[model samples]
Target chain A: MEQDPRDLEKAQAYWRENIRYVAILLAVWFLVSFGAGILFVDVLNGVRIGGFKLGFWFAQQGSMLVFVVLIFIYVWLMNRLDRKYQYDE
Target chain B: MDPWSVQTWTYILVAITFTLYIGIAVWSKARSTRDFYVAGGGVSPWANGMATAADWMSAASFISMAGIISFAGYDGAVYLMGWTGGYVLLALLLAPYLRKFGKFTVPDFIGDRYYSKQARLVAVACALLVSFTYVAGQMRGVGIVFSRFLEVDITSGVLIGMAIVLFYAVLGGMKGITYTQVAQYCVLICAFMIPAIFISIQMTGNPIPQWGFGSTLSDGSGMYLLDKLDGLSQELGFSAYTEGSKSRVDVLAITLALMVGTAGLPHVIIRFFTVKRVRDARKSAGLALLLIAVLYTTAPAVAVFARTNMIETVSNRPYDSMPEWFGKWEATGLIDFTDRNGDGVIQYVQDPERNELRIDRDIMVLANPEIARLPNWLVALVAAGGLAAALSTAAGLLLVISASVSHDLIKKTLRPGISEKGELRAARLSAVVAVAVAGYFGIHPPGFVAAVVALAFGLAAASFFPAIILGIFHKRMNREGAVAGMVAGVATMIFYILKFKFGVFDGGQAAAAGLTGDWWFGISPEGFGAVAMLVNFAVALVVMRFTAPPPAAVQDLVEDIRIPGGAREAGPAPH
Candidate 1:
């Protein structure tokens, strides 16, 4: 009933890789929602895009789009990572 | 029929749909203990995704969120950042491991991981606190929505919501709630989006609400909708729509607190466990986010559009010519107009106290779909959408309350010999009790729904998030450390909140600072979750390092949780 040591190692490696992708995605998340919306508000406000001041857009609309994109990208990367690690059950 | 007649029909339709959902749940009632708790582990990823969407999207999302965004303007980004950012942390750090642990409840995982019954009990207490606070808000929201549309008393409306939730949740358990939530998600999104589309088209000649937000308005103004909003806000002496008034450190801390607090919420975490596989958990999280984003993206647009339109059209309007919505909502006492100067015109502004309007912010968004003059049916759909958001989240939070009581308290502690069937009944009973308690709170309502919700998040962040995270990633966390951390977190947060909220410590309580100065590290009580979470981590780490390590059995359990396909090897251990 024991799991093969190699498979366990492979699973651990897959998890680590998955966590890495998540970390990268999270960095983008912080950038969009927090960095662009709040911290970079002054810098973003100086620039205008379409009808929205950039900072306002980031706060209201832009951060949301980034969040949606983050989720989809996560699914894609996790699926790929799962396949590579042979852990797609 | 007149529009009121149409609105009445819409109410009937929503009622019928809700009833059928519960009927379906009852017909498909869980047959086994596993079926009761985890839906027999057979739910499809997409379906589970829909259910998770229902669970995550609460009354706040449906009613208050858009309003918050509308009135708070740029500061509204806090809710957006906090709620959405939590999903990223959840997907990466929590969901996969929780699924691998293969438990029916959060306390189950905590108990098994720490090899201590006390850890489970502590988790139960936190879960109950968070869920009850959350469910009470939802029940109050449900009452408000129903009483507004159905012409019933708030108490009666709450009773109706309770009946609907209890019937399905008790019959089908998680399985029933899952399918019902899917339908509720569909109802809510359709209800929300249809009006948004109408309003966008009316205001900007744009049908797509999301993109129309940045498009030109009917004024032939070259400025985007957001640009127009900023100009108006400044004109009224309000802060700009996009710029924050809070210190940068405060914003960052609050945003982080909401994200981590959201990630640690037990009801939300339990949703992933219903899916069939680890991959499904990840996939479902994505789908839930997509469903949630549909509303999140449209909400700000609604806020900006509504704010501008209201200021331009209603401000300074003759009292007699006030729109029908004004008259109708006035009757409900939700919207009030007073001519302080006897000028017979309603002046809406933020400055000079004498000129400031006292309109409830909730009105700013709820009245949007109606203000834009969308179809009567679409208006009715908004009513239905609001109910779905409140009821679905209320149901999920109630279930967590039930699970903590039955699994963690009764079965684990008091009566270990109880049969599986007996435990199921206990869970149902627990749910009923939780509903009654929440309903009482709803009728009396301690504070505004938004404020109470913030307090709940603080409790969850301080008490639960660290323990769960440490239990999973760090093997050194012991029962004493976890319990002490939770106690410290909840105690500190409650004491601070009470000092301001109730003025319990009144005379020269300078340290508490009533409301203004009580914010630890500049984070408002609403945003204090981040501070509590950090405190929890520090306490747990400090306590555990000086304490003995958990027994070898606990270490193996931690090791076992990480490896997929090894659950069978661990076998069932007797208590």
Candidate 2:
């Protein structure tokens, strides 16, 4: 069966917005983890919080906490995108 | 507590959990192939989340991860970040779309998306190889736990585990496994948390393990827990607890490899197919992360507590007056101490040449309650928790292997004329045979159980992750590109691992001579998967540029999956 032309346009628009949200969220994830956690760890290590170095905290505990939050954010954002496109179930 | 009472408690707790699983299996008997394969797509999001947690946290995570952290210091964060961070990729990029595609297995998605039987066959092969490697480790874990608790040999313990798994898995399939996994998750988390809370309270006067990780010690010494640990490590010639020892590049590679590999695992991906809607898939991934984070966050605390307690308990002490727990573990060969230099005192240090203690990493979680002198019931509960983690993962992996063989290979490719009943029988029969094979490997393991399991993640990362991602997000990728990419990726990983780990083609030398100066860019075999996954993406993109684009119907299928609406209930597709 052929989809209506109007529905196709809506689907394309939904896809575009979904990709935008994913790209942005993933960039934040990479920056917090691989960037702050590893590459720039020396610079961040000069700073300390509690018993942990700033970079070391990101590597061990901070990145994972951020990952969990990022997923929930994506879920919330995509739900909004789905409602905007009339595709939510 | 006497040894007799400990044994009694272990038996009673383990028996109760097993009976509960058997009861659930009988109650959830599958009536149709769809019910057997994907649990009729009726699972709630939260229940699926709990089941995924139980299935994902294998014995390695429950039993050995803390031990690794205790020893490896900051380098252990690779596992902490790698395993949990992958859920973000799953929730955001993969799970919902795969659920919308409404398939029973990963091979189904790859086959349908590529519009080629050969692509399906390749996916099935990869899925089977990865699952088999993984199930072997779970089975070995079951053996280890049983041998410790029941005082039985490893081989007998493995056989008993195989029988229990076979009874439930063949009878109820995915439906039984799902409900049983929910129960197992409860048992494992409670078992894990009780001891951690006890140790935290004892050490830092804090009940929350996460907070206790940063709080000062309760011993009238104003020192923070991490600070004390760092000081102890430095005194012992070890790296600081908060500083990593591995090269930065290798750590990055290993972390990326584990993240992508976790996202690509067939057993994990199949859990999303059992959910009712695309939104449930997304929600379940989030819930699974929350459930998993409960343990992941607590583990580092356990690591710190165990390391500090162990050092204070044994350091500068006379060997003849060591704690009872030390002697018990030493009898089992897991903990070995020698009074070298006739000093009559034990010395546990970082320098291997002078170290007088050798402890297997697997003993950390199991011995935590004993080391802290917790009550007898909690110790018994640890045994049951270890079994739950191992059995749930083993059953999940066995199901994936059976489905790939019966549904993907035999029915889809060789005999499309087969009836639904015939396919169901094939799946059950294959599961029994797979269990037997896994049992054999568990008895006579190839190498260190945990290291072998790590290779499974590497295999998945190199072979499946890139192909699956491109299929979902890149509409122009063709069959030739995916097939070639998968082959190259898998072949490269296998060659590198075999040369470094097993010495397959290296003139029959037993040592890992290839891992020295000859290593590729200083990347270990465990971290090479990230590089190979990159190679897969590059090959697929470059090859697709020269090949014909996938037909329009395939493109439409990809487009349909990307949306969250119109997901059909998972049922038997028309043959």
> TM-score (0 to 1) of chain B, per candidate?
0.95, 0.97
The CA lDDT of each predicted structure is 0.79, 0.88
For model 2, what is the alpha-carbon lDDT of residue B448? 56
Query: Lowest summed lDDT over 10 consecutive residues: which window, candidate 2 chain B?
Result: B508-517
Model 1: per-residue Cα lDDT over A1-89, one tens digit each: 36589866886786578668877998898898888988888899888877777887887778877877887788788777767766566
Q: For candidate 1, write residues B1-575 as lDDT tens digits.
A: 47566468667877778877877797778775567677777678888888888899998888888887778777887888788778877776787678877778888887887777887887888888789889988988888877777778999999988888888888878878888898999998888888888889878888998889888876676656777888888887788877757777877877887888888899899998787777677778877778888888888888878888878767777888877787777877877777788888887787666563566676665677667776666777788888889988988888888888887789888999988879989988888888888899888887555555777888878877888888877877887788778778878777766655555677546533545655566667777778878778888888888888888787666666664442221112323
Candidate 1 is scored at a TM of 0.94
Q: Which stretches of candidate 1 lie over 4 Å from their true place?
A: A1-12, B1-6, B448-450, B507-515, B566-575
- In candidate 1, list every pair of residues with a backbone clash: A51-B224
Model 1 docking tier (incorrect/acceptable/medium/high): medium
For candidate 1, the per-residue lDDT at B488 reads 82
